[model samples]
Structure formats: C-alpha cells, structure tokens
Target: MPFFKKKEPKKTKEQLEKEEEDKKAEEEKKILENEKQIEVAYRFLMQPEVQKFSDINKRVFLRKRGLTTDQIDQAFKRRDEKKESAQTGTEQQQITQQEQKASEENKSVLVYSETLEQKLATALKNGFLSIQKSNTTELSPKIFEVSNLKTLVASQNMLKEIPDAIGNLVNLRVVQLAECGLTNDVISDKLFSLPNLVELNLSKNKLTSIHLIVNLPELQRLDISYNNIVELPEDIEKCQKLQLMNIQNNYINFFPHNFTKLVNLKRILISGNQFEKEAEDALKSTGVEGLFKFLSQ
Candidate 1:
C-alpha cells in the first residue's frame, strides 16, 4: 500500500489534449504515405521497366494496390485516345465500332496504335526528352538524339506533323510511318529529301498526291500503298538510283508515260492498283531477291 502511493501522478487535461492532437497528426501522415504509394504503383504500370509483366498480373498488382479494374483500364487508354484523335486527320479509327461512319470492311483499313506512348518513352530514354507525362498530342519539337538511329518505327501512331526538327536525323536509313494518319505530306517530302534515307515505308496513309523517287541519290526502296494517291509524277524518271517501288492497293489510274527513262529502275510493284496498260517495259534492274519481296507478292 505504501509503494502504490509513491507512484507517479496522472497527466493533466492540457497535456492529454496535446497528446491527442499528436496522434491525429500521425494518422494523417500515414494516410498521405498510402496515397504516395498508390501513385508509385500507377507510375510503374506506365513505365517501360515494368512492361514485361503479363496483362493479368498487371491488373492483379494494380487491384491489390487499391486501383479498380475500371481505373486501370482508363489509365492504359489515355495514350491510345491521343493517337486515334490525331489519326482523325484523314483515316482516323474510332475507339469503338459505334463511332465509325464507314462500314466494317472499310474500317479494317484503320490501324490501332496501342504503343505510341511506350515508343515515345523509349525515344525519351534514347535522348528525345524527359517526358514523364504530357499532352499526348502535339509532339514536342525538342531535339532528339538520333546518332545512327537507322529505323524509326512509329507506325500506327497518331502522328500528324513531323517537325522540321526531323532534318536533324541525317543518318536515318529506314522510316516506317504506316497507318499513323500522317497528313502533312510535307513531312514525307522532307523525309524523301534526307540524304541518307534508303528505305521508306509510308503505306496505308491518307496522301492525295506525291512527288516520287525522282532524285533521291541514295534511295533504293519505296512503299506507298493504301492512300488517296492518284498517280505518280513523271519526275520519277529522274531518280536513277531507285531500285524498287511498291504502289499497292491505291487509286492510281494512269502509268507515267515517261517511266522508260529510269534505266536504273528495278523491280516495280504495281499490284493492288488498277493498271490500264501493263507496261511491257517493266523495271528490270531491281535485285529481285534483295529490295522488294513484298511488292512482288
């Protein structure tokens, strides 16, 4: 009984109130930490470093980290919508079939790009920009490090205009802009003018007219299928270095009468387009085994 009486006294009301306030603040801090963790999980989903995970695993990880299935799907969809919107320039494919004005057969022509953002992220890591996230449209005009960047595969993306900044990629050998809804034909013209460009793939775009391989000193192959192209310009007769040309499934109604001038012109792929007169003088110089196997088919 004597030892109990010698124990310390109980805390006062003022001290008790202060301790309560401290406890509340600690709880709030914990809540903030949880929110930060959620953001981390979402960023991991978008990063390339975490892209190897399977789709099901990704969803499971997201759900476990407090993201709903609907929210996760929405996160993945943000980039796709940007590309589709840009494609709207000429042959834009609606995200859903209900938005389509054309029939199912015509709709097949539209290519859906699901990896434009991922590709951009890779480009950034390769010296394009530090794009953590930004407007999905309106590609930045910042200089990209293209040292020997031979193949620029941005096909099926929502790319409308290539900034004049593209001229910096002097060592480009192959450029694939197929089905990206690229309308700025000027970009293609600029691309053709690149001194080092050897192979070009501009298939399934929305071009109405074009200047073909007339004077590309090093150009060896060209593919311009599935567009609104009417005819190849007669100036193509001047490109003596061209070895292969693919003009498949387009709106060509006439063959250039000056075609015979390209003595160095090789394998010509005029299939998939309506040919009124089979030019008896087909290109004979194209290495049948090397340049245009797709055109031959």
Candidate 2:
C-alpha cells in the first residue's frame, strides 16, 4: 500500500452555513457589548467628580480599569456628539419660544386694543383671562359676565377678596390667585363651588384654613403653600380627583381623619410644617403614600 493518509470528510453546505451564521451572531454580540462598554465609560467619565480629572489622568484612570485607548476615544467622541445635539435642541427650542412669544405679543396688540376691562372681557370670550401685576386692586364685575370663562389668573395683585361673582363662571376650570394678599375672611365661599374647577392656586397668601363646604368633583391640583393654614378640612378628602396638594410652610400638625380616603392623591408637600417627629420621619423617608399609611394606622 502507498503511504497516503485518508482525506477527512468535507463539511456539508448546511453545516458551513450554520457555522457562518453562528460566527456572525457572535461578532454582533461582541459589537453590542463593546458599545455598552463605551456608554458606561462615557457616563463614568462625565460624572461631576471625574470631570475634574485632567485629560491625561482620565485616560490613565480608564486604562487602569481595563478600557482600551480606542474605547476611551469613542466615549469622548460620543460625549461631544451628545453635547452638540443638546445645544442644538436647546437653541431650536429657544427660537421657537421666542417666535411664539412675538406672535402672542402681536396678537395682544391687535386684538386687545381697548380699556383694561374691555381687554379682559375679550380674553374671557376667548376662555382665558389674566390680570397680572397691573396694579389691579379688585376684579371688575364686568369680567364675570363671560359665563364660559375657563381660566382665570389674577396673580401679583393687591386684591383683598374674591367676589361671589366668580361663581357665575360656571365653566371655569382653572383659577390662580397667587400673591394676591388674600385673607381667609376675604375668600368667598362660592370660590369653591365651581362645578368644573380643576386647579386652584392660592399660594403666598394669609389664608388660615381651607374650608371645603362643597365637594369639588373635578379638582385636581391645590396649591396653598406659603400661607398661614392651621389645619386641613376633613372634607378635603371629598375631592376624589385630587392629585397634588401643596400645603408646605403651614402649621398643620396632623392629617384629617378621612385623609386616607384620597386614593387618587399622588403627591402632597407637607414640609415646613409642625408634624410630629415620627410622622415627619415617615414622610421624609417614604413620601406621601407612606405618610398616609402611617397616619391611617
């Protein structure tokens, strides 16, 4: 016999294709992992403390952590790209906002061209009214003529009272009376009687209490912060749709007995108040839900 070795069997087409597919899959997986590594390196290098490091020191630090020079360069490249993208987005947003503001100013000049009261009436017809920082001491009774008013803003005024005429705006949804120097006695009970009221902001005032004589079925946001409130009304839980309540810097020591009934409540700011140490600690650590749970027990 001749001294010839037998040839090994060749791989079939299917077997070769399977091997190629597996090799490609593995290469894709490695590329994905490398991208993830680059992302992690980018985030790590962008940390406030790490950003203080010199460029040379940053590379040395990453190298000691098993990152190659190529990965560090990619991370820096990604960071620069993200920064450029963010700057571009911010510039675009600013430009859009400026254009919109200019448009609004032009509209105001063209449409609201009469006396202040007439301008407010025009805005009310458009379902919006704002009388901010105009030395407004009181709301003109003429404003309440618009029954379909949806939003009302009277912020930063010298107004001392909310007239009962506000209740005539049956379709009112939002009311902002912030920084109006209102006292508890000056707040008309009808202010809480609006059927469609959703948001109410009476912040930076001297109100001592929130007396909910009627259920506000649509009320969602209530901001009474920076006020002199002593305690919340037990009927506050009747606002089944209430989501956010800002009662910070009040004198509240305990929650209303039925407060736990507010299942829809999402956030409640109770800081700068007089809650007991245990209650305060619970709120500080576990937030509104935990505080409510603690109070319920």
Candidate 3:
C-alpha cells in the first residue's frame, strides 16, 4: 500500500486580507507613537525651566528620558520651525536690538566664565590670551572686540577653521595655532596682512599651502613645520625682516630662487623634506646657510 502525503491548509482570501490590515495597523501605531514621542520631547525642551539649559545639555536630557538621537533632533527641528514661523518683523527687530545691546555689554565685561568669551575678555584686558587643549572648535565673534590683543596662542585645540574676524586684531604680534587641526582653505588672507605680526607658528597642521606673506613688515620668525606643503609662496621674500624659519617635515622639493632675497634670515630648519641630492648634501654638510648659498648660486 502507498502512503498518502499530507498537505498544509491554505488561508482563505479574507484571512490573508486581515493579516495585511493588521500589518498596516501596526505601522500606523508605530508612526503615532513616534509622533507622540517627538511632541513630548519638544514640549520638554521648550519648558521655561528647560529653556535655560544649553543645547548640548538639552540633548542629554532628552537622551536620559529614553529618546534616541534622531527623535531628539526631530523635536529640535520642529521647535526651530515653529520659532521661525511665529517670528514677526517686530520680533526680528527686537532680537537684532537685543544682540546689539549684548555686543555692547560684552565689551565692558572684565571677567567672564571659562568660555571662549572669557578668553576674548581676558585678551581685551591683558592683550594676551592662551587656550590650549580646550576642545575649541570655533572662535567666538567676540574675538573681534579684543582689538588690543597682541598675542594669541590657541594650540592643541580642535579648531579646524579660523574665522576671518581674527584679522581685525591688527595689534597681534604673536600667533601660535600649532596642532589646531587647520587646513589650507581655512587660513584667512587677512592674517598675512597683519602689519604688526612678528612671530607666527602654524606647525603640526594639515596645510598644503599658505597665503602669500605680504604687508607683514614687522614679521620676524615663521614656523610651518610638519605639514603637507608642496611649495612656498614666491612672495615670501616680501618678509624682509624675517629672521628665523622652520619648514621641516613637509613635501617641498625646492625653495624658490627669490628665497635668497631674505637677507635677514639667520636660522632655518629644513630636515625631513623632499630635496634634491645636491641641496640635501649641502644642508647636511654646511647647514641652512650653505643650502641657501648653493640654491642662490
């Protein structure tokens, strides 16, 4: 006798339709739940008590309440949209007036909390400011208020870009932004236009080229070591007062012939760069002076 094979029962058309309806219902429920969460997060963020918290702290608060980063961001986006939608022309003028008043108030403050504003305030008062390893990503516009700043050392920070407002500090004599994660594009040409800048150190950065060294009649010492520079600007000869330079550990193959015009240059460091055999030998045998003489001849 042959055995009969068992066959599974198939669902009715109505049953299949019911399953699809259940899936659609579940998706709608999830969407509603997400919208509710976003609404709650936005309300919590806009509460009078929560309004005083920083944006970073506000995100932390939402995360603590079990909202994911995407949910928190969505809530903030909604809040910003609402704000923009509700803002009238009168409100805009009021906000602008308030900002102007705040700017004026900032100039008179002598002491500030440990923020970039504090650094600018200190620079305003003392003409020198140094901020290192502070995780600073950007400079505050308040920096422009510190017009009397003479020395600014913001090394070892996370500032990948330098703002053009820094050029307003025309009194700057020393600027050291080494290890600040700078690139070629972020450097301002107005930085090179500082008439009083004497010492500039941009070492250990990711720069490929720097702006022309022009209008810096008082510039003396320059350091741009440990970068990806392929060539130096020919206008570097304009820094007639340059006394010392350090361009070590870069991709440079040769110096511009105009480099020989730097009559005041006394010391230079050119190691760990790509130079021709004769230039390398000259530098090894007789130092930067011999290399300069050889390149000149």
* lDDT minimum window of 10 residues, candidate 2: 86-95
lDDT (10s digit) by residue, model 2, range 1-297:
679898999999999999999999999999999898898889975765344334544554465467766787788778768667432112334434544664576534212222354445456448888877666667877678767789988889879689999889989999999999999788888888999999999999998878762357899999999999898887777888989999999888888888889889888888899988888787778887788878978
lDDT of 1 by residue, 80-116 (tens): 4633532111111222332243236443222211233
Give the clashing residue pairs of candidate 1, or none: 266-286
How much does each candidate deviate from the true structure in C-alpha RMSD? 14.9, 21.1, 15.3
lDDT of 3 at 41: 93
Residue-level lDDT tens digits of model 3 in 155-176? 8977857878888999999999
Give every collision pair in model 2: none
TM-score of 2: 0.59
**In order, what lDDT does every prediction score?**
0.58, 0.77, 0.77
- Candidate 1 differs from the real structure by a C-alpha RMSD in angstroms, to one decimal, of 14.9
TM-score for candidate 1, please give it.
Answer: 0.49
Q: How many residue pairs clash in each candidate?
A: 1, 0, 0
Q: What lDDT is reached at residue 202 by model 2? A: 92
